[model samples]
Target: MTFYVCIKRVGDILLSLTAIFILSPVLLVSALLLLCTGEHLVLYRQRRVGKNYRPFNIYKFVTMRSDSEKSGTITAKNDPRVLPVGRVLRKTKINELPQLFNILFGHMSVVGPRPLVRSEVDMYPEDLRQIVYADNQPGLTGMGSLFFRNEDDLLAATGKEPATAYREDIMPIKGALEAWYRDHKGFVVDCKIVVLTAWAVLHPGSAPVIESFRNAPGFPEKELTDYRTLLARTE
Candidate 1:
């Protein structure tokens, strides 16, 4: 690995360990709550496309019914599969805390493209598929996750079938965002993305995070316009 890559890996290990330590209480409570209610599952693991197109199990807290995938993998706004406690977890992003372990284990980074499921990966723009994750490990949070923070609601607002909207409209923009991150990947950029992710979680719908990257090369203009138009319809 290059010096930057080594440093990033080290940072991921240290930050993930620190986060797990600091958030142990929240993690414990979330786990206990899940185990006691909502189909009684704590952690949910599913295969996701990783660096170099490898498949690995990505971890998260169970925020939906055990049989949720049978209906569809694309979760919609007010999805019926979501449990009562799940809404809290998903809303506050506590459900994703288990992924700190994934970071610590070197399966992911602190900031990179958010990992996608096999089906979603297949939907990526054909040109972007090979290079999106070629150098960077999938992340717990990144540009795609940040900009599409309200993806469930956006999908609902599209008024098209969830899979169709995602395949046709969402993935193209998400793919471009991931490519942008790849082009700008570095220590400072990663730090900015990490802070922006936290900001998005704490202040959902308050502002557009994409504005923060107004000068970024390869900014997805048409996709973003379509995204905002759909978002406006939601309100």
Candidate 2:
């Protein structure tokens, strides 16, 4: 690995460990709540494509019914599979805290492209499929995660089937955003993404986050315009 890559890995370890230590109480409470509710499962582990196309199980607090995937993998606004407590967890993004462990274990980075299920990875434009995961480890959050922060709402606004809309619209944009991150990957950019992710949790739909990286490489302008139009309909 290059010097900066080594530094980033070290940073991921320190930050993830520190986060886990500081957030232990919240993590414990979230686990207990999940155990008592929603299929009585504490952690939900799903297989995801990680660095260099390696597959690993990603951890999250159980936020949906056990049988949720039978209906579809794509979750949209007010998805019925979501439990009552899940809404809070998902809304506050507490459900994803378990992924700190993924970062600590070196399966992911503090900032890079968010990992995707194998199927979702396949949905990327063929040209981008090899490019996205080849250079760096997948992340707990990244440009795609930030830009599509309200993805569930956006999918709902499409007025089309969730999976269909995602495949045709969101996936391509996500691929482009990930590609942008690949090109712009660096210490400062990663730090900015980490800050933006935290801000997104506190203030969803904040315009500053969108403005932060408006000049991303291969940014799909027409598609983004259509997405903004769709989001406007919901408001």
Candidate 3:
């Protein structure tokens, strides 16, 4: 795991710096649009669970109304706080590009479980903590993220009860997916996930990545069972 972390860290740092150069125009445009909308801040920093379950402020280019956290951490599709450009950023996953900086600083990786906010981390089922954030750094892109690319819409569609649906429906599947990544950590699998992420963002389709997950092995049975329990309840 340490070797993986070392490899992942160096890989991410180089890539993040390169990403910043290539995506400068997009970031500038996003920042300007956010300003015009009176969103003010160009970046949003929020506390998220990190390696060793430590809390750290994760950075993201601000995409919603300032003070959006007054409502909550999770963003549902059509969330009123979403700025005009924010929607585009979210759709293209451009919003996450800045976190490459996080990777450079050792707060994130190119592949691993997406970090959860402290509040949400506390809500995670304690019994499953080991599998949830066990190995691999929380990454810029990951299996769970690939699986739930449309999550904001799903949560929003829950309508007046976003919290309930998120807690019982959305969260559990993410847990299963992340736990799958945790136990199956390896370079080949990691590279495959990163490739899937790129394909998903660039192509905006489900075919390739969906097939990959369906074929992936070593996803913990307990996690899948827990996921089913949640799905059954949600249904």
Residue pairs of candidate 1 with colliding backbone atoms = none
Candidate 3 RMSD to the real structure: 3.2
Q: Which regions of candidate 3 deviate over 4 angstroms?
A: 157-160, 220-235
For 1-235, candidate 1 gives per-residue lDDT tens digits of 7899999999999999999999999999999999999899999999998988888999999999988889978887888899999999988889989999999988999898989888788889899888789877999999888888888887888888889999887888888888888988888889888888878777777255767777666777877777677778779
For model 1, the stretches where C-alpha displacement exceeds 4 angstroms are: 206-208
Candidate 2 yields a Cα-based lDDT of 0.85
Clashing pairs in 2: none
What TM-score would every model get versus the actual structure? Answer: 0.95, 0.94, 0.87
Q: Could you tell me how far off, in angstroms, the CA of residue 103 lies in candidate 1 after the best superposition?
A: 0.3
Q: What is the C-alpha lDDT of each candidate?
A: 0.87, 0.85, 0.74
Model 3, 1-235: lDDT tens digits are: 4787677677888888888899889888977877776557688888888877776778887788877889988887678888787888888777887787888788888888889886675555566566677655788888778767777765655554777777766766677677777788788988898788878777865567655565456665555555444333334
- Per-candidate Cα RMSD to the true structure, in Å, reads 1.4, 1.6, 3.2
lDDT of prediction 3: 0.74
Top candidate by TM-score: 1
lDDT (tens digit, per residue) of candidate 2 on 1-235: 7998999999999999999999999999998887887688888899999888999999999899988988868898888899999999988889889999999998998898889899888988898899889877999899888888788888888899888889888888788778877887888899899898888887778477766666765666765676567668668
